[model samples]
Target chain A: MTRTEATRTGLDLAPDARVGIIAGGGSLPVEIARALARQGKSPFVVMTAGEVDRISDFDDYEQVTLRLEDVGSLLPTLKKHHVTHLVTAGHITRRPRLSAMRLNLGLLAWVPSLLVGVTQGDDTVLKLFVRRIERSGIKVVGAHEIVPELVAAEGVLTKAAPRKSDWRDIDAAHAAAKAIGALDIGQAAVAVGGRAIALEGVEGTDGLLERTRQLRGHGRLAGRTRGVLVKCAKPGQELRADLPSIGPQTVEAAHAAGLAGIAVEAGRSLILEGPTVVARANALGLFVVGLPAAEPAHGK
Target chain B: MTRTEATRTGLDLAPDARVGIIAGGGSLPVEIARALARQGKSPFVVMTAGEVDRISDFDDYEQVTLRLEDVGSLLPTLKKHHVTHLVTAGHITRRPRLSAMRLNLGLLAWVPSLLVGVTQGDDTVLKLFVRRIERSGIKVVGAHEIVPELVAAEGVLTKAAPRKSDWRDIDAAHAAAKAIGALDIGQAAVAVGGRAIALEGVEGTDGLLERTRQLRGHGRLAGRTRGVLVKCAKPGQELRADLPSIGPQTVEAAHAAGLAGIAVEAGRSLILEGPTVVARANALGLFVVGLPAAEPAHGK
Candidate 1:
């Protein structure tokens, strides 16, 4: 749906429909909660026990902390508040340890799947976890559904536009990022001198940029600049959960890596604190562009 | 040719064919030099001004040092010594600085290509550099030509062979390595839980493994082990230069990264100091295997 349509219909839910924000660490969850509160639809916040660091952000709303092991209590708590929809946000740095889990009635059935999923990659574990939640009846919605403006807009977002050489690096990095994404590996890549110089793996975007910085005077990229960082959703990825994102911190990382700019897939990526991100990019003399949706690579 | 046939023919060059070793920084060049010397072919060594760390290794042979900027002098020096065959070994680490160059008459003609190639990737620079030498009547040969036994042998080389799960990781990492190689990026990748976990960038294999080590308790790889590191020649790569290689250092890196094993392409990859590498792998309880040459990825 178009941005306007999504914004309009997103808030048109039944007055009795309650939303539950399964907040993890990061400002994203607080932003989503604040947006919902502005619409007179204050979400019942459910923060993971060890993951969430700040408690005061949800002081104005009804919130509860639950251990990941006690995920069994999640649905019942949401059900108690008559929650009809759920929104998941932020990062879970490590997979839940199986040994620490004290399986309750709601979690017992998931024991087998959890055992298997815990041994897999993040995407697989997340897919199974979300699937379990959806099977219980409440609908899972993306944060963008609640705040359409959070979705990155197409075209350059910062005052500094990408130069011709920067555009070439962007294209190379985009292709490399997409290639790895196809394999369910990562969503980010960096290109220098019109060739891919780095690919993100499980280490994530921060690690990728730090590595690019370390390679500055090394072979292939010596004395090279005007490189670009490209981030996009993995091919056929679950949008409600892990959409690739950039924020003010990302702008700083890009600048530190000596990159000319950052480009993220428009409409498919999240630009958290969009104004702040753009302002930082502008101040640092780095371009921040949102790429138009690309055609499926395999179809090409 | 078979390994035995290659060894025989490698040493069966014309009696008047004077060999040249363009030694860089590594044990591989020293190993190749010793192998050639053993065959009664005392090679004339050409060392890059800053690359070679040990002059004593070539003390028994005729040698000269030339700056990469004065590549023009390379051909003249080789011709002065009547050098007919050339083998490049080890690493240059960084691209030559253009500002340091003082273009002589011969180098003056190569200004355009050098200007362009210097701004490109390592493969491009190496290709242009070698092509220029070939144009000057010197035949470029692989280090493997001088020491065919240096080529990795097929099957498990270490006492510890890979488990079934480790083999799965090897397959996944091999595909990833080949995919990146097709882009002329790098030749190594790591896989864990049957998924590509890390890819080698300009930071190279050591950096790749270090990154993997850092990611041990992170999202996807939390408590995960039995990962494998895969290295192979790039698709349609210039075999005479930069064939993927692994030595005792690689074994230690893989072990430190908690990888179960390493697999390198047999017949196409170098196993420097093979005995020491195998012994180290065995002591560390990590498998080191040589996979037979693979069919072109596109042909599949």
Candidate 2:
């Protein structure tokens, strides 16, 4: 549905539409809760312990938090709240090591499939969770559905436009980032003067930016000015759980890295506090562009 | 032809036959010279800068070394040497920056295509150079042609076998390494307890090994007694140049990293100084396996 149509409808969220949210570690869950509140719906936030913070806030929102391993409790919690819709957000910084996670009977039954999916490098666990929620009669909506403006658009978003050389570096960094993403290795790569300086590994984007700065300090960067940082969703990735997102902090990181520009996939990416991020980037003289990744290069 | 057959047949080395050797930074060139000597042929070695050392020995063997960027002079040099067969081996550490290279006219002409090819991460620049050589009437041969024994075979080579847990980590590291290789980002990845700890970048494998050791010393890898290091050729990689090779030093590195095992793609990977490498790995109680990567779960 179009944005205007959806907005006009005012979103038919039940006053007590027990929304189930599989919370990760980030402020996204809090933002999601606020959005749900606007729709007159209260969610049962199943927060993944060690990932989520501010547990007391969940009480204020009339929600509950749960450890990642408490899958058995999750189903009952959803049923208790009569949750008709489910949404998940936030950053699960640490993927529980398969060996370390203690699985209960319900989770044990799904272990074989989960292992197969993970071994295949597919987000099988998340998919299975979604399926379970649907089977329980809960609808799952795109995280952006409640806040469409958070979805980034195609075009230059920063006050400072990229210089010609910055554009060239952006182009190079984009190709490099996609190459890395295609391999499911990382979402971002930092490049300077047509050479890759740092690749994002299991470390998140911020860590990668910090490493880029360090590498630059060691005289490994291409130019004296900061290089370009490019981030994109992996080709054929399961976007619901881990879509690439940037915020004001990302702009600050870019400034610290002395980046010439920051380019992210348009539409597929998220821009938390968009105006603030752009303003910060502009103030730092860092160009930020949301380039269209719709037409991904063929045979990727 | 079998080695014995080729030896008995006394293969002809025409004065006009142009051979190209894409030399990596290692002692493999010396061995290549010995093999070529047996055939009464001396190949011209094209060494990448900052990779190979002691080029003076090549003069004694009637061999010539050229910079990677001197593409304009490469064809003429091959013509001068009457080089017909080309072989590439050793470690060509990925450069931190490409802009510093002084691309000659011939290379400049191919820059656009090369850029697209390189950025696509489908083929290494070394492989691209091989294609250019072939187009210029030079035949590229597998480095193993000179030392067939170096070509790794399927199955465990070391006496010691990996623990069950080590096998799991090895599998995980193998998958992760292939993913990294597919991106043309790196060839090696280290994983302990199913968590990727380090990825090889511009830093050579030895340096990476040392870093892993240091991290282990700092108690970062406390519970994980042994990590698995997986190295593989990039997907659709050109076998003629820069085929991944593990030698005695690799085993030493694994021991230093406190790694339980090292896995490489069978047949596709090279085992330089095979006897010594296997003996050392066995001595260090490290398992070395050459498993076929034909059906690797991920693609380049």
Q: Which of the numbered candidates is closest to the native, going by highest lDDT?
A: 1
| Candidate 1 to native Cα RMSD, angstroms | 3.5
| Best prediction by DockQ | 1
Model 1, stretches more than 4 Å misplaced?
A: A1-11, A111-120, A295-300, B1-11, B109-120, B296-300
Residue A297 CA displacement from its true place in model 2, Å: 20
Give the per-residue Cα lDDT of candidate 1 at B297: 17
What is the per-residue lDDT of model 1 for residues A152-188, given as tens digits with 9 covering 90 to 100? 8789887889898888788888988988888778899
Supply the TM-score for candidate 2.
0.73
Q: Each candidate's interface RMSD, rounded to one decimal?
A: 2.5, 5.9
Q: Is the docking of candidate 1 incorrect, acceptable, medium or high quality?
A: medium
lDDT of 1 by residue, B1-300 (tens): 114334442556788888899888878889888888877788999988888887798899999988877876777789999999998998777666677778688778677677666445566666776788788898888877778887887898878888988887888899889888887788999999888889998888988998888888785465576799999988877777787898889989989989999999887898887878877888999988889887431110
Pairs with steric clashes in candidate 1: none
